[model samples]
Target: MADVEEMLDQAREMPYGEARSILLEQALKAAAHDRELAFEVRLELTEAYQYGAEPAKSFATFSRSVAEYDADPGRWSDWHTYSLLWQFKWIASDMRRFPEIPLQRAYDALEEMERRYTQAGYGSHAIHTQRTYVAEHIGDRAAADEWFHRWQTTPRDDMSDCEGCDPSGKVWHLAWMGRDEEAIELAAPVVAGHLTCHVQPQGILSNLLLPYVRTGRLEAAAAAHLRAYRLVQGDANYVDDFGDHMEFCALTGNETRGLEILQRELPLLDRSPTPSDRMHFAGCAALLLRRLEDLGHGGLTVRRDGSDVPLDRLRAELESDARDLAARFDARNGTGEQTRRLEARLAAEPLVEHLPLTPHARRVAIPVTQPVAPPPPPAPPSCSTWPRRPGGAATSTPPSPRGSVTTPSAARRTGGARTRSGWRPSWKASRRRPCGCGSARPSCTGRRATRCGGRSRSAGSACSPRTWLWWRRPTGGCSRTATRAGAAARCPAWPRPTRGPAGPRKRSPRSRARRRARCCHCWPSCRSTSPSRWRRPARPGRR
Candidate 1:
């Protein structure tokens, strides 16, 4: 027993790989001398092999531990029970990496552990969560939901050891169900707390990006993406989470960087990648490339490790790989109905489709064709309420006779203007015109009015008689409606100079030549008559 303890200590301290494996092997040999010690050593060996990424070896060692435990069914300890349950959880995770191993095998292992040690009092939450995750990957949504509900409802004992396991699974479940806000609310604090674990930080933050982006929390989403990227910076086995991270980069204006990472990781992924991993990476790559293309960046070349390839070609390659992976899955899994369905989903046409990113509801201002007219004068005020003058004093003066011309001071006081012909309502008064900018603010209407052809002219300009026309022409152009009878007729064909001498400026030969070249370049059909003069001179060796 002392020798076994020393071996375990050495194995734990040593870095993973050959050295630790040797120490663990020695411990396993020493443990065999006693049945109880052998059981303990076998558990440690299983964990060591798992951490070393030797799933097959870990699975075998774990089977041996289970066998040893079964041999002495009548005698059991809490440590043995807990070890068995932990092994069961990890086996499910292993099954994901090795699809040939039926997931049911892991499910049965957990059930056997539960039956053999019912009194050991292990919390069933972790087990249920693992089973739910397995069921989801295997396309058993109904069973997954059932197990998830069981996990959520299970009571945790004070002695439960896996307190940090809930966030990742819960966030994924809630996000999948479209309860994104609730998921974000639950996950944000946990991520901020900086918990460190294989499934956490990286896993939680990766999944959190989905809801964060959907809710328009772009800054939070960007932070989560960066944190997740740092967490898995060089870890290639995290291919499962790489897809989500790439998605975050693509959606948040980092598609180039995401492609660079993909190229760097391609070699690693090509070595021993599972069908699922390949499928996921391919999907993410295709989607990111598609997004880049949609943003008018098509034909962009990605250069990495001395190789250059256009994004379109990369997308095509990924799509082909995805299809091949789906075919392999179908071949291995057989043509059963469920396998067929899963394969179809995996190989569906349109390798990449945009994910729905819903934005918050807010009013969007659209350009109005005609300016909004100001409100009409209030129906002649009732005698009950006396009209107040512009100076805010109650006016005893009876309403001006319908067409009477009043002094400018009287017009200002009455909120009306007296033109030479008649009295105009307050809205029609020059001072109270609506701002034609489409903003509802009454003060902005005439502050900066646009002239003919949408040209913005300063207020009180005498160039043209400006009416509130929402549709203005481009600057220096005449408006069609204005030219018909209003502002356009009075406005010059081109804006008159505000200050400089108004005649055309003389151009130097060089400037004239530059203008001619520009005109020819912009309109190819209008090529310059002296093409040879504008053409570049030939190099010594070139024609």
Candidate 2:
């Protein structure tokens, strides 16, 4: 018989989280007092929250176990009895968070368990189970199957009865690895056989549903998932209710419900004392969100105020709460990366846009017809031949020149002008001339320009030089010389002034210097400037 006091002593030396499993088992195996096992039991239940966001609490527990065994290895003889249970719990919890633990660590854990059992001699069944697990985890399906066969054939104790539960577990592993047919075959018997067994069968059955889903037997998958759901409550063994339920919902395309459950469960689980617990919950939440998005559904959902809001909205609300909590908590002594990570996770939720405005929500009136712009004036008629002035020297009463125009108002009429009010004879010429200071000189003062079309009492006063050169009539009192002066004053273009000496050209040294720097800031186009000076600063107001 195992020594109960020695086992409790073994547990008392361990950290509560690690010690709890062994202590509780020892309490049962030895019928030890309640006070001795209570502490470890509580610690075991809270282990997940204690290891928040960590990959596994088993690693820490295993590390502690190794240290304790190193001092005296025999203390673990009975402890190894619970090795499979602890390892399974560890692996389940670990996988929920860090699915990618290094292959070597897994191999070592399996090898270590094998070595311990080989030394113990009576642990061959447990050894086979663990070996199969390791082999499967490392992608050795054939080896895993061989070990599973070995587990089936190996001799039994009362502890070995639990080994059948492992086949259901194997089904999940096979399904995950894409060997669905084999997984289903292995799971078929247990699905029917083990439901009546003494051991709580939810863990393995839930695991088997994955294979059924993967194999495309949706009806079978749904049946198994619902069965597992009913089987997990108040179990003698472990139950990942939220995670299993999530898998069930996701595979069946009940995404909306899956997300709703996740949003609800995540917070309640985070309050668990073990860090490992928090990681498990967080990892599940993350995985569910990721899976929903993968399946083309939006992530989780939540109830806000009175309505069902998307997870994104709920997360935003939480993030605002986190800032207030952070300030209130005096974070220096409280949870470290965990609080920060939780806040960050809450903040990472995508921003949600509210629903479209309803008719009742609107307070302002909108115009029915967009305000129409006033219709533009009709355009002038374009002509291929030069316009003729009536009763002029050109072709009628007299003969002048082809390019010359009549008075400005008469010129406008022949150009076939159109006006906003109505067509007018002088409108075309009146519209074409610049009325402001910044008009371009050459184009406006060329041989093409017509004389101002309004009737004029004066000679050249009413007509510019361009008009005299191009006009047909010279009735204005203003002299033609004054018109020439106006053109010369306004423009310094080509064809030199016809009647007077040219004006002196004034220049500014400052202006010349400034003009040279114009393209200094523009590279490539102004290659004369050095490349380094391409970004030269503007000289105060000069640009």
Candidate 3:
């Protein structure tokens, strides 16, 4: 037994293909020693094969394990038998590509598992949960509801300690019941915390996204879709979840990105995906392409390696694949329920178009007892209220005082100035400080001047004429005018103009002649010299 366990552990540490081979070899060796040990080893081998995408091999191995256990039931415990039956039921149902067991066989297996659980005095929550799922899949709403209630009310002590399993199952049941709003409410916290197992996160979040979208909760739907997408991307083991991710992408205007993912994953489908996986991927591809067709891109094209393939052709191919897979499932399962559902879902009519923009639940508003506060008083009219100046330029005015406002033009016309104390006559007219250029100085002639050589002006002095000139000129700095006309009339910085020489000196005749001679040597066009003569001679020895 220990040797079998050790071999299984070692197999787990290897890649799926290698692990499946090792486990199969170990199971054969263990069969020679003990039937019980052989059964355990084969169980591990079955999972390895499944993970490696060899569903046929996995089903055969699992069947052998079950037969070995049945030959001598005393060798295996009830718990082991129950677990085996539970797993077998799911595997059988998922055999959509090439089913080896009928749907009735899966249901019978579930019934046997339930009997084993009851015989062992254990609650049948897991059994009931699986029953609910099967019922829902077959569109047996009443049976599904009854099983859901059974699962919900049953004690969970005997159920596996998978943290996400219970909530994810409940969410699925609620969503199928058309109670999507309730399902989303329950799933929001789980998705937010990123609590997920191999199976639950993809199932829970993907199911939640549909509700979110239907209820105008696009942001939440997008977030859930992204989380679900990241969970399955690059991991072929989770291809079962890929269809749900693609469906969300199509509904949420992410068809382009979804199409890229589909193209990338298409090659993997040919590499021996399970029947369920093949059906799912093909059905989702068909549905998405159908939606694209309905959106007016009837001749949509998929580009690969500079080659373009019509989307309709791709859709037709996928639909054919899905139908073929469904036919195979129906052949083995002896029931076309799931296949029929798949065909119905992938029909040309758009399912998303029928979804409501909001949830059916009405929001209830809570009443408050506190009195509402009054709104603040209107603001005083701003300087913007003043008329434009005669030149069509906006006049600048200071912010209005607490009780009174002053317009620039009005202040100028009234010959009054606003001061900290209040409105006052303009510095008593005569006593007002002279302009920075000096009251005795003449007005600017609008000509350029030499650099200042006067005494350094005080830092607080008014703006200089150069500053004012720059402020007033179109291409100069400080395009905005002063807030007050009186201030605009004065230099912001009062720097006195220097009396230095103001213009460039005239060049001497000899200097002018030399410049012309230099120019003639540089360019033959200046003196009409021959091109060869105009060129400077190379250094004597270098030539």
Model 2 quality (TM-score): 0.39
RMSD of 2: 24.4
Please count the clashing residue pairs in each candidate, in the order shown.
10, 40, 9
Q: Between candidates 1 and 2, name the one with more favorable lDDT.
A: 1
Q: Rank the candidates by lDDT, best first.
A: 3, 1, 2
Q: Runs in model 2 with CA error above 4 Å?
A: 1-106, 138-161, 177-182, 193-199, 213-219, 231-241, 268-543
Residues 1-543, model 2: lDDT tens digits: 246556656655664343455454445445435432433333343343233322344455445444544575554445443543344435433432332444455556556655654655645666676666655544456787798778778876433435456566566666756777987787666677644353335556667655666566656765666566565433212224555666455445554555666655554553443333334344445544554555444543555445776755543444444444333322322234335544444333322111111323322221234579999996432223333435534432122222222222334445744332222335345334432222222334443433232233222123422222222232221222333335334432212323446665544544322232221111112223323422223334543
- How many angstroms is residue 374 displaced in model 1 relative to the true structure, after the best TM-score fit? 59
How much lDDT does each candidate structure score?
0.58, 0.45, 0.58
Query: Which order, best to worst by TM-score?
Result: 3, 1, 2
RMSD of each: 21.2, 24.4, 19.4
**Predicted model with the maximum lDDT:** 3
- Model 3 residue 505 lDDT score: 55
Which 10-residue window of candidate 1 scores lowest in summed lDDT? 518-527
